[model samples]
Target: MTQQSAAATPMSKEMQDCVQACMACHSICEETMSSCLRMGGQAPAQIMGALMDCADITRMCADMMMRRSPLAAEMCAMCARACDLCAEACAAMPDDAQMTRCAEACHRCAESCRAMASAMM
Candidate 1:
């Protein structure tokens, strides 16, 4: 398809919501990572890794959706998985407010991305 045509095509509501969720999740992951760093040795390596992965994937997924990339659906699927993992990691630290907030964002993003991926299929 031509770039013009692709640009002219409007995104479905689901895709838009997924993009927003991904962006939100990305922001929260970054914030959570900062919070974890301030905690020093309290945060585990695994949780940090999960937060990093989620932050990167969520940003990329949102970009893909915004650009209407042909691989957006695949990215959404991957994003959902990443979000789920991140959420689980964050949930492990339930006592931390930042972690809890990040977990909630990840959960919402995961749900939105899952819906978008399935709808695209």
Candidate 2:
């Protein structure tokens, strides 16, 4: 088959960076969730919800982009929103080192996802 006929296209640098950011965000979210759970009643339910949503969305977004799915752009947009919410939630507990780190990761991922979504438009 000719190169043009292949199902997959090469990923641009922006997409690659976004994918990396998504994966990183996913990892941090997972870690933060565990930390929250270990903190007993210290972490609020809202924060836990945001972390869960961000983790799931970021993982799915990265997978979609890596596979060059037609819906990858939409996924990225959703991922960005999730990341933003997660970041805001994490920022609520500035005293916690894990929360601070997770917030930073979420912010970076959100920025990258936003850029990727715009570029795909």
- Point to the candidate with the largest lDDT: 1
Tens-digit lDDT track of model 2 for 1-121: 4434423667888888999999999999999998877778578999999999999999999998887777888899999999999999999999999999999999999999999999877
lDDT for predicted candidate 1 compared with the true structure? 0.92
Residue-level lDDT of model 1, residues 1-121, one tens digit each, is: 8766876799888888899999999999999888877778578999999999999999999999888888888999999999999999999999988999999999999999999988877
Candidate 2 yields a Cα-based lDDT of: 0.91
Off-target runs (Cα >4 Å) in candidate 1 are none
Q: How many pairs of residues collide in model 1?
A: 0
Question: In TM-score terms, which candidate is top?
Answer: 1
Worst 10 residues of 1 by lDDT: 2-11
Which lDDT values do the candidates have, in the order given? Answer: 0.92, 0.91
**What are the per-model numbers of colliding residue pairs?**
0, 0
